[model samples]
Target: MDNLQKCPQIVDILPTAEGQVRPMTKLEPQEQHEVWLRAVELAGGKVPTGRIVKDVVQKIMERTKVPNTYQIGEVCQILVKDNPELRGKGGCWGIVSAVNEFSCTLRMWDGEYTIGLQHLKSYNYLPAECEQMQVICDACGGLRLRINRVYSSGLEESVQKFLESLGKLNRASLTALEEKLLKVLESEIRD
Candidate 1:
């Protein structure tokens, strides 16, 4: 016991490079308890229950994790915060025309632009809303294959209809005039 006072003590241990330390070594029970107590103190002195902590972690992951895949026809908004090429396109909504592993081809009002998945945010619209957006896009000459060729004055009518329906789509509600216009267009297409 007299030799203990003469022994050298570890004042501070520097962080070693990752994997240089014994990565597979397990902490002793007492050491683990000490670590847990430190963590609790760091976390506002709250003693977290296991089930509640697990649920909170899961919710955090769901809210923070970026989606790995995007589907065609999904309505998404372009995020230009970190992308220089997408300037002036922030808050602009688009439809996904093609989907790649890590990117998507978006069809916007002016033209189509290929953007990365990280720079796109889903609008989370219902299937009917998506279909309505597609129709509106088709009328705007984005998807020409599905567009009806009926031209009132060299595509002027289609352009006007596209603009009119855009407002209704955004609000998800149609005025009386818009309902009449929709009926007229539907009958015109049938005839």
Candidate 2:
């Protein structure tokens, strides 16, 4: 028996789906030598004798075509048709600050904010003409104000807070009136 048959490191040559017999593991020294001789014979003696034959795993990376929907630094126009805060604020413009697979960062006149893909309309040219010209706030005595600017700034917040406070006051007054009515009913019942 040969030393290759006695060694525990013997590798089996298996036929792959491609019909090629591939060595799957480390071989004994004698088996390695035998493989070299067989490889040289297969190569028609073109390879030098005693040279080792090794099988290396090569990875082939394929270039896939990925669809690009949007990108950072791309200027896009905002579609505010469904946004209540943006209603009547047409012609307000914005710039794309950052981009990702799902959303993009938008820098508007108010400040930098993030918006979804559905919220964007199309790529816009920089220096786009503001469609809605600045209008004087008739309520504030004709002070020039951008519509979106007014909606996003402290003016809106202050107004909302004031309304909320008024609502609480109204609720308290109603509760007090209900208690007075209950007291009057109790006094009449006693008589």
**Model 2, 113: alpha-carbon shift in Å?**
1.6
Per-prediction TM-score to the true structure, in the order listed: 0.41, 0.30
Please write out the lDDT profile of model 2 over residues 31-112, one tens digit for every residue: 5456544444444543422222332110000112223376555556666533455543344345566776546776544456
lDDT of 1 by residue, 100-140 (tens): 75579998755678987667999999999899988777665
lDDT of candidate model 1 versus the reference: 0.55
Model 2: clashing residue pairs? none
The local distance difference test score of model 2 is 0.40
Best by TM-score: 1
Each prediction's Cα lDDT score?
0.55, 0.40
Let me know the TM-score candidate 1 reaches against the reference structure: 0.41
